[model samples]
Target: MQFVIRKLSPNDRLSIVTFSDDAQRLCHLRSMTQASKAHLEDLVDGLGVINMTNMEAGLKTGHQILDGRHSNHKVHEHT
Candidate 1:
């Protein structure tokens, strides 16, 4: 839940920069208007959420793998 506000006075200016990707996708802002900026910010926030979810899922999977290995080790020792 972050807010972004960009205000450029008549004298102020802005520039946009982008790099080429393997997919040959062109990424550029459609406009510098308030609504566009808000939309872009929302997209960024969504990406953050997705990234965190992936990280948490990975951690859980790792823990499960480790627990399985440890359990197998203990059972072998008892036998």
Candidate 2:
């Protein structure tokens, strides 16, 4: 995660998609900045292992998040 954060440019946008059997959603999207980067760092620090593994549900949720992002940025003209 740290590596990912480091590789992001200031113009980059990122969203965190978290999932579990009982809960799944796009945590949020933020532009990379000093504060935003710190926010990502904090999120990573607070992470905990989910004992209930549900890969299918997690993937579905992630796909939904990506779809939403794509739709939301349609004006940006995603090809």
lDDT winner: 2
State, as a TM-score between 0 and 1, how close model 1 is to the true structure. Answer: 0.29
Candidate 1 lowest-lDDT run of ten: 70-79
lDDT of 1 by residue, 14-73 (tens): 222111110111123244566656655555454322211233333333343444421211
Give TM per candidate.
0.29, 0.68
Residue 59 local lDDT, model 2:
59
Worst 10 residues of 2 by lDDT: 70-79
Candidate 2 residue 29 C-alpha distance from true site, Å: 1.8
lDDT of 2 by residue, 1-79 (tens): 8779878989997776554443344346678887888888788777777766566655555565666643322111111
Per-candidate alpha-carbon RMSD to the true structure:
17.9, 8.0
